[model samples]
Target: EDKLSQEEKQSRANHLMEVQEQISYDLNQEKIGKTFKVLIDKKEGGHFVGRTEFDSVEVDNEVLIDASKFYCRVGDFVQVKISEATEFDLYGEVV
Candidate 1:
């Protein structure tokens, strides 16, 4: 802690955060317009919250399935065609 100035430490932290954000954005971009198998986790408002096979229940990204297009229950696995993606969430429809 004594080796670096407070400003230096803050700059390093900010840089790391920016790099993490960029990596997440790039990964999400790759999923756009792609399809993946996802497990329905729960319902949020009018959308079904789900996680793809590559996602972790606790930390990985989740996809929001438009509930109006299909009826799904929690814990059900379904294929989703990804339409949009953000750094942390994806929006899609059941395929």
Candidate 2:
């Protein structure tokens, strides 16, 4: 019997992660280009950070909006048109 090498194990793990990421992306593709209501949470760097109903308040996905597009304060609810989606974040513009 032959034993698997460390490199082989690492390669397999990386491949599995890639496959999982692709699956997640496919599942979320429907959200792209859709408008969603998001609660403005706070400002981070130069962008405003917020999340939608599909996200958790503390530890889930977040949406990034351009701070220059509109005037919004923390705790405000605004409608956004989602323009991009990744494995863990969404980018949008004010609707």
Top candidate, metric lDDT: 1
Output the worst ten-in-a-row residue range by lDDT, candidate 2. 21-30
Q: What is the C-alpha RMSD of each candidate to the true structure, in Å?
A: 1.5, 2.9
Clashing pairs in 2: none
lDDT of each: 0.91, 0.86
Q: Taking the tens digit of each residue's C-alpha lDDT, what string does model 1 give over 1-95?
A: 39999999999999998999889989998999999999999999999999999889879898998888888999999999999988889998898
Poorly placed runs, candidate 1 (over 4 Å):
none
Give the Cα RMSD of candidate 1. Answer: 1.5
| TM-score of candidate 2 versus the correct structure, residues matched by position | 0.74
Superposed model 2: Cα runs more than 4 Å off: 1-16
Pairs of residues clashing in candidate 1: none
Per-residue alpha-carbon lDDT of model 2 for 1-95, expressed as tens digits? Answer: 55999899999999998998887677567789999999999999878999997788777778889888766799999998988888777889988
- TM-score of candidate 1 against the unseen true structure: 0.88
